[model samples]
Target: MRLETEMNMLQAKIQAGIVKDETVGNTSRFSDANPNLPHFQDDLDIWLTRSERFAESKNWSRDKWSSSLSALLTGRALDCYGRLSSEQAQDYDKVKQALMKRYD
Candidate 1:
């Protein structure tokens, strides 16, 4: 019984750690402003690459990635969201790929 209680306590600690990470990760890290419009594509691309590297399971859910990306975009960069097709908007991977294709 003591062993089981210890295991449960360990599991709670591990779960709590994951939640803390997810909370921190949800914040926007990319910047939307760059004087050179073309160069901004490189910035966005690099951000995406880094995001993938840090993503849980090395794979970010479509909604999670898209939400993060949207939070960071500004100006013309933000306008790209309007271009999403109905089908693409519904899928996170499709939204990510479409935005990358258009912006990066």
Candidate 2:
């Protein structure tokens, strides 16, 4: 129920043009590059854990980490990533921390 409310609010924001649709778009800059990434499914912590493990399994470099993971984000998670500064967005650790904070 709480999650549904949040989704509705996010949808409303998108419709109002407050949160751009691009922020929640299913396609991302890195999607084509890394098609196997696990997407965020209304749970930041679980998504982050899964993404981190996926990154490790793929041996994704620190440089490519954030972009690769960003490909899988949607809804508020995508918005959180979009809100990051250019430098922060490039560092997976910073991106992770920011996302955890946003969802917390």
Against the true structure, what is every candidate's RMSD? 15.5, 8.9
Q: Model 1, residue 13: displacement in angstroms?
A: 29
Deviation (Å) of 79 in candidate 1: 0.8
Cα lDDT tens digits for candidate 2, 3-89: 554554444333222333466675333232363755678877777777777767767666776766675677778777677666777
Candidate that would win on TM-score: 2
TM-score of each: 0.42, 0.65
Report lDDT per candidate.
0.45, 0.65
Worst 10 residues of 1 by lDDT: 30-39
The alpha-carbon root-mean-square deviation between model 1 and the true structure, to one decimal in Å, is 15.5
Model 1 agreement with the true structure over 10-97: per-residue lDDT tens digits: 3323322322246656522223211111212446667656554545443545445444444344445445544554345445577567
Kindly report which residue stretches of model 2 are placed more than 4 angstroms away from their true locations once superposed: 1-35
